[model samples]
Target: MAGDEDMKEGGLDWAAAYRRLDRLAAATDAAATTDPEQEREVMDERARRLARTVSARATPGHLLELVHFHAGEQDYALETRFVREVLRSSEQRVTLPGAPEQLRGVVLLHGEVLAVVELSPLFGRPAPTHHGPVLVVGQGRAELGLRADRVEEVLSVSRDALLPPPPALGAQERTLVAGLTREGIIVLEGEALLRDGRLFFDLSEERVS
Candidate 1:
């Protein structure tokens, strides 16, 4: 009986030792599988590849800064390279149906019938009576005119100066506005302004007539 009890105790000790050995083996395997040096190598290779791709895609071009005017306020900036032309307000004239309410009329800019949109009413403000210059932005196949109260001087701003737009801007402004800068937010929706046919001049034909 004494011998049997000793054997049973020994058996338990062996079983416990085996369990400890198994746990240690599992820990060693996990450590090997998650080697930090291997992970670092993979991350380094991925970063190098990404940097190469970005460097290859980069191109050189002339950068231009444009001041976007709206209502009585000067709100945003645009890249002048994107601007097709600038016209006098008197040169643009209002036309009949097929134009949007926000669209004052179509202007013949560069031999293209460009829709001229009033910026004030689109921003929920009254259209200013102020005579200013019209900026003709080239769209896909056509161009759109944005009538501003005035055309400020073209500035040469660095790309770093351009920042993201403010969170406080409303939905319409958000859609139209791009990022902000020390000057103000930049407008990136010149294409959107032209494509959105719903924007028409506030004046009716009868009223103008």
Candidate 2:
């Protein structure tokens, strides 16, 4: 039930906490010193060490590596293997007139016209008007530029910490969601997402308005 503030208040810094028993050993070495102040210091240090040890051991372990970013109001992540590169989405993109609304347009990247997909709609959220950056995902012809509201940081997630999508999610959003992270990040099934959407196939042949 304790929060981060509680841990900080108790001096539960990991490194210091893990070294709790070490101070006990040090106290033994200084056993010959009869100075009351020195003895009191050692006892206080021992208490701090005990607190840290309890805190560290109680913390659960759940870690997975992912490239995280923001889209709409939610946070999302893709495994590093599926990430090709990340570029600014502010650069003008050539809009595909007849493509699905999810397909924002195509952006030129490294001399290649990369099809950009707006994930907000696919996740059942309203499309964001302001673009942040292009998260280049997948590889080869399956590569895509995903429009992110903001690119956060690469995270290490714990498999056990992932939660199932809420039952209230629409089928489309559920299909794209791998699971919800303990920290609330949406872990996406990158390969399944791209395969299911098939964003690039027949993109050159725009639909007639």
Candidate 3:
């Protein structure tokens, strides 16, 4: 296993990779000191290059990385690979009238419009009042903004930790829920949920102010 191999070799050269990326960013910033348009172009190019480099280094296949969060007074875990980033939800979210109840609104994230999903209603629970961070997830043309009452942590657990979902979970929920972690966190198949055309609300047709 890669994790075991890492343990044996101390670990991957994360420090060196970080330093290299930092230096690349600094160099990009220094090169973008000209006009605003030129700076934006240069920054975007460098950022894409940096992202490619980071994504090329894959996480261990045997390790299930999860980002735990709360939505309807219950904890849920999403595979970290599907999570792009987590950001505070305090920013003004634009609501699209006539949209489904599950759709909270749209939030601008990194120059892209992400449809914010209120998951409580999906499970027949009252939405949690505590505003927390939004988990940004992207899959092809669909980008989702999942709000949580609290973001627990990014955990790396062995694949063996995942257990099959209980039969008590309804059909729809079971489809979305991959399994349960060893500690009993409900592990969600976020990609499956995003791909579910019936559950997904396309914000592309809606106007965002």
Candidate 4:
């Protein structure tokens, strides 16, 4: 939070990126063609374009755009580049058997099974009364829906504003933190959170026993 005093209300830049994503997403889902081959080709091109657009969104000028939210009583944020969307509800969340405590459950999203991660155990905080918004993040198998209490707003802050996490936090908890704001909001490194082996479980039949 060192340089966070300059944090201006964000709506234009981040919202515009989301608008572009919405248009591209609608285009893919609404692609219509009499020929199946033509439709495939069109979809492929749009996907490639979207990939490029996504890569271009990486912190420009060391200015990080973050999606701020609450999980229980703690405040947290993740870089906007990794956030795909926010779902108000995790409908039909199917609880898994014999899974790690942090592996909350799974939900069918966009025709794929997305794992819903329980953030409490990860942060060493107690579980919330119930799940709230789901922040859809990451790519393919590594993707997850982070259960949250409420989403605040997107804000742009310079990377320099982040301070190293307090020394007393455990190694596991410290690994996920990119930095902490002076006000105590934990800004997490998106890729580190996704790559955590604990979040992705291989629930084979035997493993589920």
Candidate 5:
């Protein structure tokens, strides 16, 4: 059929993928299983399926993968390539003296102190006294965690779909945002974020001395 041919031109059999997702959904037990681990796995699978759906909406070769997340009351996204991992925030966070106000604290990540950034103030909101999960991102020495109130899921969008930041955003806010999607996700400029010197602190000095 023409639909199959259309999907072929895009390089993905999106229809087949959607049908398989439907089967998975139908097989899920409505009763809700008691196993936390199993439930987490199921949710993750659903997220993956949703990402595929978004990718299908975008043109095949032009798709840009993003990790969609919630920060404060707003929605945001970062290119998947910059994000190394998502870590659960810990209450044991240690604050360092003389760091920028945006620096929330440091979290123990894989036997190292990973600096955490709080962007709420940049958007005219009061900083959260308690940090949320950390989005591990950046390049080399700049790699650190960006606090998020909640991580929704990973997604994909067409390059053409990213529209310019709306006029409602303040000057500072405009500088941080690369584009906004129809879904209301403000896509931050990953390279600009990585190059921001404020995000980096010489942690190597604190390392074995």
Candidate 6:
């Protein structure tokens, strides 16, 4: 019985020793497979990790303003703050017989006549009816009305969110888009729309004899 007990203890000790040797052999094989190229790859991965950590801690500087709107099937946004008021669909008086093809007609707002332009037509899309709300935009020395399907909402976005304009935009669209945002492209040049003769009636200049 004593001999049998000693043999059992010896077997247990051998099993533990075999497990330790197996673990050591696996570790040795892994170390042997790590060549110079693998070591460089590991170092490069560590450098990239450090770079990302440092960049995340850096400070960002700049702010952006965003104005949201909708055009046709797509939604859009502008950065200009010239928007004064948003008016629902109103009666427009088609008085001008000769006007630009894009010009829909004229509308009276608060005792003043304002030319209403279809925003979709300017973007190379099918023109929308002047039956919707008029986005009243106040430019440097003029107030113009822009007809839109729906005036969604206005929001202020940061500069980091503004993206560069795509190269596919037409000349007119290029002139209108200031920057791209998550909401849409910001119409930085909306004032130019007011400058168009078809969309504005200059009241500042009078006939001089």
TM-score of each: 0.53, 0.62, 0.65, 0.68, 0.62, 0.56
For all candidates in order, the CA lDDT equals 0.52, 0.64, 0.64, 0.69, 0.67, 0.53
Count of clashes in candidate 2? 4
lDDT of 4 by residue, 132-158 (tens): 888888853338889899999887878
TM-score of 6: 0.56
Q: Residue-wise lDDT of candidate 5 within 82-194, one digit each (tens)?
A: 67666664543555434467876565554455678877777777777656787888643337889899998878788788899999888867878888999888888787777
Off by over 4 Å in 4: 1-56, 97-99, 139-142, 203-209
For 1-209, candidate 6 gives per-residue lDDT tens digits of 01121123222222332233344455545764777677677567657744643343312235544346675655665434556555664533332333354555455554455666666655667765436676667643327766666767655566657677667887766766656776455445555655555555432113111
Worst-scoring 10-residue span by lDDT in model 6: 1-10
User: Distance (Å) between predicted and true CA of 146, model 4?
Assistant: 0.6
- Tens digit per residue, CA lDDT, model 1, 63-143: 435545544465655555445555654433433333344655445443334556777665656666545677766533335
Winner of 1 and 5 under lDDT:
5
Pairs that collide in candidate 6 are 64-159, 67-78, 78-186, 78-187
Which residue pairs come into collision in candidate 4?
Answer: none
After superposing candidate 2 on the true structure, give the runs of residues whose Cα lies further than 4 Å from its correct spot: 1-63, 97-99, 140-142, 205-209
- After best superposition, candidate 6 residue 102: deviation in angstroms? 2.0
- Per-residue alpha-carbon lDDT of candidate 3 for residues 32-73, written as tens digits (9 for 90 to 100): 665678888756875874484346333636777777888777
> What is the Cα-based TM-score of model 1?
0.53
- The whole-model C-alpha lDDT of candidate 1 against the native structure comes to 0.52
Better of 3 and 5 by TM-score: 3
The Cα error of candidate 2 at residue 145, in Å, is 0.8
Among all candidates shown, the one with the greatest TM-score: 4
